[model samples]
Target chain A: MIKIYILSIFLFTGFFVNSQNLKPEIKYLQIINNQNNKFIINDNIRNAEICADSLFYRIDTYNNDVSSFFLLLSESYYLLKKYDLALFTLLQQRILFYSDSINIYSKKLLNQCLNKTNKKLPASFSILEKSLDTILFVNSAQKVDFLFSITFFINSKNTKHKLLNLITFYEKYFNQNVSFGMAKWKLLNTAGINLKTQTKYLLINDFNNPLSDYDNQDLLYNLPIKLKNKILNHNT
Target chain B: MFFIGLLLFFASEMFSQDVDFYIKNQNDNFDFQKMPKEMSFDEYNILSQSFRMQDMMFGFFVPGYVHFKANDKKTGYALVTLSSLSYATFAYQLVWSKNNLSDSSFFYNLNNLSSLSSDLKTNTLIMGGALFTIGSSYLFDIIHGKYRLQKKQNAIRYKYSLKASLSDAYIPNKYSNIACFFSMKIYF
Candidate 1:
């Protein structure tokens, strides 16, 4: 009878400990859900921050998938214009999630923060170069978004060579996907705008500038109009 | 049946795992890598505000004014041309008539110098008024066009600046030192 009593006691303690461990995880999850709903549904950053802070408090620092939580926190900070803290959080995300995809996103976020701080772009393009192949192969909307971002950054910095390379990549992408659609229209519009901006830049820098190697005046003028017509027709 | 349903509802609430289940499901589908790395809301807001200001300054009324002024220029030019031509013709007629009245034998015999001078003065006054009106209108148009162009150029030339400062002030023997201060200023 004593042995059986001791066995029951051990079983009770084990279950209690298991429940205790499960409670925090469950609480953390509930807090995360509340945070996501607040942020995504209500668009309430303040409430989301409260829930995120609650989750952070409960989360075990030693062992947990902290990347998602860190991403949430950083995004909130970013929206709040606390960029230094956002940058620090992203660095932590990099350390935790050392995947190539995360690295690309982290670098992109870092670049944005740097841009906002009026800092020069990092001289090394190694991260972007390494991720280019993988990004190209990914059949997702992100492919266009990533290309657009790089193009926008290059245009702002007036980096001609990198811009040309991105343009070439876009041409290749268009050729690979021949079906005319909204995505294609968006890409065409972006390219046209970038081309027009580049021409303006050239005009400002060199009044007596010779003809540009990439300048197909006909394409430059017609492509944007064609894209607009396509969009209008699609919408109608 | 209602009583049973209420009891079941309370029981389900007591054992609810909906939040946990939803979070787990979301985790399964969430791809952080695919998330867009866009600019901060504050930066985007500032950019959009500046764009709105630019549109307000240069896009709406300014463009309308420029187009209206351009059309006005064409009409004003035509009016000036016609008025100048008419004035020149009248002046020439007055000059020729005056010379004839001074030299011709018929006018000398008629001795109508007062009438001839009166007609010449009337013609000169009309010519002078036409010249003044056309000249002033043309000058006004020129000045207005110049002002519009200058306003447009100023609107287009947007500038932005960021400044940061740190300072500490001390008045030794007179007062306590001021604490170190830091500030950042952005101008657009």
Candidate 2:
């Protein structure tokens, strides 16, 4: 009986070891990390792309670690000035990691990639707007930041009307019984700035105006004065 | 001893690579998906149907049943409150009759008819019936709401394939007729 027990234990140990070996190995992780470091820290785009591609080709698409590997591959493509390929790879990653912070990062990177390719700014603004709308109920600060970023890209007359409507929505929200949290204030200020910038751009027709030209002067100096006075009167 | 400990560690590490652990750890990462805001079509249909059934059954007797179905909360509350007050009045009259019955003087007087006046007895019966009807309707609404919520969740996760087809059907003694059919294939 003792001999049989000993034999069974040996068999179990051997099977366990074999099973461990059968599991897909992340042996490429260290190599991918090294390549990423070389690209990010040393700024050697060509060598990093070669190394990343070689390592990435060894990885199967169905592998559990494929997303991470693809992220590195996309980063390499971005460093290599291959914006289109980078955008495509990030989009693929977004499909796999839907509604993840990694997807958000991919979107930010996509915006940058599109900007580099000289695609229309409205398309990028639309992406931000969609993300903003998605996270509106969950994260107010992120929603405000998205609105702030959108203000930079609103150039045409039609988009300006849309922005005006958005500003009014925020203004009404702030004026209502809703708690005036930091995010609300930030959103209001962003709307004011957007209005001022749009007015300046429309009146001057100069997109290249320097920031120093408007120093110490409120761009929304005239628009919000009445609202501010009303608020002050209510407080007093 | 060191070798055994190392073996145990390796075994645990290998065990931790199981699919459950992988999924649990993956879900721990931050997710940015939006919460669903609007009622689905199935949910809307269920609510509206529940409202219609209540209207058909009790709209005349129950004043705010239709309003409640239409999502007028204030009117619904007012009707429910009135029903409750009527039920309370019936209870109070029953208690008053019980006290009168226990009073020997009133029982022997032969002037009062069975300790409760005929008008009060009739009013109590009407109130009781109205209360039962309104209460059952409210209870049905609650149960239907719960059932619809569960069905909505299931519908969100359920996968379905819908196929619609149109074909020509031959008639024995007349022109060919057009036939249309819808096929729904659902996977749970």
Candidate 3:
């Protein structure tokens, strides 16, 4: 009975076309952390306004990653329905100067803000899912940084060269940043810490414990070789 | 990627030697002798069943269902948590709604409803985010699961091939190019 009335209403009131194809209009961008968790960001104007004020207070506020302040400030603008301000804030980091910056959340928010304001997409606005657009032009200094990064991934000898090979592969196959991260230098420090923790575990555990427990990539398979080396080199 | 890989993948990607050969020699890696074991259709039902796009598509709706099927529990749980938090935002928005406007009638109260409330201007930001988490999670699962499945396939192939070397039952007799077990002809 209720279904029939609903159908009749739809038929009479020009509700023939389904309007599902439109792009999403969620006003604010998500605050996705490294763990893939979205922290419940308070959209309170006072907090957001304070955040913007605090950004100016420190050349290195918000955990010393100054880039994050832009995201917070832009996100504040988005929550406050200040779409133009959001677009303007995010664009500066994305295209104007920090092109080398790996802060993708800002780029993502830029796209959202662009849509909110019904503006044309900017050149800096690439789909944020995973475009490591600038990796192909890596300079010598960045290439060296891969050695420290590579140690976090592989447990093999000649890790430095292997990282280079992977970087080339990333350019050839992925054409993106090594990690799908938004903040700068976080991936390196995190990977380095994980590797350090695992290395210490392997040294103390008499090569019996596994490195996979430490979240080191594929190190479980390589542990046997290291174990054998430790055994062979052990002095009585 | 339309967006990714992590550290352990270096073994799959760059372990073979120089960059030049890695690209040139991808074919060499495909050699049957070195090929990962022929995974039984049932063994990797996920890959074998991917021809059914419906199943893969449905997996996306459940948010991490594909990853759970892929046996990547760590990632699967993360996605589940992400989806839950994403949806929970809606509940949060409802309790603390800035506007009196609620879309409860968007589905149930359609007779009185004339337009879609789930648009860019809808006061609820959570509605837009609902699809984003699930969609991204499913896509990530597909990429991560592909590598994980391949790695498992390679591991099993190496294990069985090593066992076959001593067993002689699966060995290729030099007189015949075809291997008894794999039934593949050696080129060189």
Candidate 4:
């Protein structure tokens, strides 16, 4: 009876160990990570594409440790200049990891990519990042707050964008100097103008209209004035 | 449609003789105005026959008695009529209600069907309300069935765990099992 009991114990222990030792059956995470790390350090587009392709192929079945894997995959795809795929992967990560604390890193990666591309960012990213930046920088130091506030206003839905631009314009004058935000707002307005001229069609609801409940006209007038001054400077 | 066709067939047969006689008399130059206004036997038979047809087509579907253990069709018919009468009375009370103004038009339109001017509207509201109640009961039954099935499934997945007590005894407790068996499926 004792021998039989010992045998049963041995069998159970062996089964538990075997189950625990079983690696992820479809082990693509490590392979993708190794390739992405190499690309990150060396900026190798070819290796990044190979790994991104493999990662994309298994996206449907991926459930464990999703946050880091998709972040790396998104950066890797962006390195390969696959902007559309990078955008799609980042959006998927947002959908899956929206409530996760580590989503900050994903948002940062998205912002980095958007900054590198010099055109109108996707409306979805603009709206999402605006909310994210506001939450993240709402209680930071004044300098960081000012920087983030400017970024948030510029990236906010067009109406809020105009309001923030106005607030920041007067803010710079009162603080006694021009700032990077003043330049960035000029860039945003130029892009908005270029978009209007290039495309005959406009969304019936242009997202850039000023807020409906603005109690301050002085703040409202400042944004267009700054943008107009920037355009005049450029022509002269 | 078949019943109406059958009714018209019988009606034509009963009326054919009187109609033929009237036409024949008129063609023979006889003055028919002096005749009595009363209908002939054949004409009366045809006229009375139609009332029977109307009763057969309309009233047969209305339940005469409530049988608890009767067939489904009979039970459904009984429930519909009883529920319809209750709803109609409730609707009438609501429309004529002096305490509240809300849903006044709704109740007024429904109750106004008894007034010949709104017969169509009254019948529609009653029939619609009856069917709605029947459908709600059927859907509730289906949802209840699913809930019972889920309970049975959970019962099948329960397991008992043994816990050691301070008195050197063990107690058995039941819990729902959490582990799921994974399978990968591919369709060609």
Candidate 5:
């Protein structure tokens, strides 16, 4: 009778323990916190190594049931400075969902963005944009759009299209009064050298030079004559 | 279910061969072994989070390879057997589809010509074969999502079945059990 009762207790506690084990959501939150605090956490290579090993251990124990694992893995790899692995791992997971099931919305979108940034894979901008166009797909689309815009802004080749995509995405799905306008300005400034429009290029170039108030100071700063000429033309 | 599992396992194993071949034939170069284990700390953090999300949260999570005890010896085997099975099943379908292509042109020309063109018949068979292979593999991937769950269950079982070790090392909370501890033997 005692053995039977003890066994029941054991079973109940076993269930309880597992029920409280590191949940996928909790794990993901921890990883995000780590990323935010990486400057502190990364002060020691030993600490970084410890965290990396811990993450790998957790990943190895993960069951393929969680939808977020692939995302978490991608993030973890990114943190480890393993850009190729992070991108490749995400691609592998995306292929699994794409070639297998319909529940591949986020993975496919993220894959598209990463592929574009890496320039290792083909860009499916239309497919990503089309999916993000839906209201019901808002949550997934927003998360994916954020990644897309960040990747696009960083990429040197498709600055115009990337900015346009971000602009369109924000204008259509997000509030116009938001900080996305700041992102637009940054993009324009970054890609300003290639701008064909004289006014637009000057606006960016003036912001970069910032020498209208003092001429001798600008000369001492060795500001380029062509840039000074462009600035003068814009001011006049 | 066991037979189905077995069937799926072999099928996926077969399919992986075709996928491997196709991926190889595409001339897209990648050396998986040469790739870095970890990148930026942020990237590592994300990959870890993604893995946990994929494996532990929504689905039965399984690592690719895990240690299992068989006859008192630690043996590492693939935790996700279904992945291998799906590959095998896909392979079988690919091979089967390749062999069953109908010579439509030969039939179309039967009423007009006395002989069928050998090259046309051969090409049709080859093209059909390739499509069948690709189509079957694609289908196998779709069908094997559930099998992936089963593989995760097997991994948990394998973890539980390991023999108890002697040392009672207190592992760190931040680190995973897998890499938290190591044993050192000292002779004084």
Candidate 6:
């Protein structure tokens, strides 16, 4: 009994000391997450509005985890059915995090927005996509798989007639674009094997690695016999 | 229900392969393995909060860890079994799906194409359903553990929140548990 009492006192004091020393940023993140739970999962719009406001104020665009804030904000908007606002928020995220074209989460949210909308994508989206596509070929992000956000966007249920034409154009454009390794891994994967080779589009290679990159345009289009042999063989 | 949803969200967050991959691809400065070299007391104090959050997150990552934490051994063991079975089922299905795909060939023929799409849809739906079950068990474990801990905390807090004025002192044998007894009571 006495030991239990001592242990309890130790824990109490530790908690008190810990609470007194928490970082304001960290504390605010906790508060925001709790409020997000109330709204995002619990479906409390009032709390969602409050959460969006709190998140909006605290977002440090320079912070690495700032995407989480942007995502949460967009999600709050999504629940509120303000999809255009959601897409606009994600557009800002896309432009700011220019190097993160491979981020599937943002793309998925964008897909949800596009599927739910009746209108054509704003001109800004076109302008942004043009610039981002340039980044994709020039300074290719290393961590990206073959699946880009546009893949997700393409798969979204087309609500606009203009969007259908755009998807068809994109389909022809990206047909030959996935990394060799990602394409092979798809064959090994359950869903990948089921879908025809043409349907698989994701960013799956590190540009830094020659083996993964397949820098030669022709080699990128067709996986070379030697590349196949090296992968299939246990020893390189 | 609210707590269940919260636990499920964290459970998925803790277990998501995509998030794991994303974290690996992100900058290395956030890695917890290496300690920061030579920090002031301020940084150290702030760092301690991360460790505390990590302590909470540990409960999220490990199946039944929270239940064990709350001292419900029976429930904890049950959760462990359930989650293990859930993982096993998911793995088995994945393996089956791969093998099933390998055994089949896609053809441009209309009949074959329709069957292939249907098979793909069914396989994916099965995987999604199994994942939902796995997530639920993890959710249950966390909620039960937290609820038990909260119950204990409320009991302790209630005792501590009571306040009383010191009064009728050591009246012999009046109060056996203490040195003195209070006549006037205050409740908060």
Clashing pairs in 6: A145-A202, A145-A203, A145-A204, A146-A202, A146-A203, A146-A204, A147-A202, A147-A203
DockQ, Cα level, model 5: 0.01
CAPRI band for model 3 = incorrect
Extract clashing residue pairs from model 1. Answer: none
Candidate 1 residue runs with Cα over 4 Å from true position: A1-64, A96-101, A120-236, B1-188
- On residues B25-102, what C-alpha lDDT tens digit does candidate 3 reach at each position? 357435443332333443444433222233344455676765666666898889889877877765655555434565
> Tens digits of per-residue lDDT for model 2 on A1-236?
99999899879867654433212222332243355543232222333333333332322233334555456556666766766556545543443223453556666777887777664544544564466434425343234334434343433332333343434544454343222222233333444544454344332212223232341123324435655454344434
Candidate 6 displacement at residue B95 in angstroms: 1.0
Which has the higher TM-score value, candidate number 3 or candidate number 4?
3
By summed lDDT, the worst window of 10 consecutive residues in model 5 chain B runs over B65-74
Error of 1 at A86 (Å): 1.9
What would the per-residue lDDT of candidate 5 be over residues B1-188, giving only the tens digit for each residue?
Answer: 99999668655655443322223344433523221222344333222221221222112222232122111112222333534464455455445444764434433543444354564444444444544554443333323433433444443232222111111322334223342323443446
lDDT of 6 at A21: 20
Candidate 4: TM-score, chain B only: 0.24
lDDT of 1 at A211: 31
Predictions' DockQ, in order: 0.01, 0.01, 0.01, 0.00, 0.01, 0.01
DockQ category of candidate 2: incorrect
RMSD of 6: 28.0
Superposition error at B181 for model 1 (Å): 56
State the lDDT of candidate 6 residue by residue for A89-120, as single tens digits.
56544543333533677778878887886545
Residues B31-121, model 2: lDDT tens digits: 4333222334543444334323324335445645654554545756776676667567757756775565444332243344456667655
Candidate 2 residue B44 Cα shift, in angstroms, is: 21
- Per-candidate interface C-alpha RMSD? 19.9, 23.3, 25.5, 27.5, 13.5, 17.2
